[model samples]
Target: MMKMMRVAVFVFLFLGVAAGAARAGWDPKDDEKAQQAVDYIKKNAPALDRFFVHAYGFAVFPDIYKGGLFLLGGAHGQGYVYELNTLVGESTVTQVNVGPQLGGQSFSEIIFFKSKADLDNFKKGNFELTAQATAILIKSGMATNTDYSNGVAVFALPKAGLMADLTVGGQKFSYRSR
Candidate 1:
């Protein structure tokens, strides 16, 4: 009986390792970056309808979780980044996992730019919105008019059932690379 229990534990641990390694595979059906980015934007369209008629100055980033435990053998964890488009009021989603890490958080942000140059940079870079760039979480708690940086205005409202209203903003967005 003890031997059986030990074997079961081994199997569970083995499968967990395998599952963690395969965490970075995105949908292969449409393999196009632009299309996926569009789809991602459309999924959250209702939240961003205010910018619908505009020429396209909005980008959506999704939620991300970053963490991992490194075994004495090696380190492993996963996270993704996305780019979005709402030119025709139809958006797209694209995803890429950052690979193994020792420790860090997976974070996603939906960015709405007010300038054409910023939007163009988004397209050319395949949507690498990093801290080197400028960003803020609108729906995020403690987000206020004062916290905004750059020329960007963060307008966020509730999307899910979250009751986070420490302050009032604009859109309720959920974006991922998809």
Candidate 2:
């Protein structure tokens, strides 16, 4: 059936993109990449400094690859999770969406947990970000007074590429002990 074929092709393309991203410079142990991400965020979103210093925990995904074609799209990235300034674990993110969309992009994302309970829930290996979850785009002079909706605040910085997508998607995160 045409529907089955379309689904098959979508899966193939999604997996290819995910595999390519995994093979790219996405190593969880890349300290330099992690540091660069941190520095970029601090410099561009100074207001987040307060959040960074005060957050019970946070996760930073240095580089995420996203791509889409027609009605299918996905993204993947690896990152480090920290608690009280100490490395706590490694995390991976995967997102899938369906809608009218096309193109590809790369970006960095950070999520801050406002409380110990929130961080604990995220570290439980079943954390997910629904379509309702929103991420602020990092820009110069951006205000940091953003409240933690649902105990979490997210920020994203575009790195490279371009994408035009209007889709419904959510991100799922899996964590592992460091």
47-123, model 2: which lDDT tens digit per residue?
78888988999999988898887877888888888888777677888888878778999988999999989999999
For lDDT, the strongest prediction is 2
Predicted structure 2, TM vs. truth: 0.85
All candidates' TM-scores? 0.33, 0.85
Alpha-carbon lDDT of model 2: 0.81
For candidate 2, what is the total of clashing residue pairs? 0
What tens-digit string does per-residue lDDT give for candidate 1 at 15-75?
Answer: 4457344324355542454345435544544444444344336543343332322211111
In terms of lDDT, the poorest run of 10 residues in model 2 is 18-27
Badly placed stretches (over 4 Å) of model 1 are: 1-56, 68-108, 126-134, 138-143, 146-178
Candidate 2 ranges beyond 4 A from true positions: 1-32
C-alpha local distance difference test of each model = 0.37, 0.81
Clashes of 1: 22
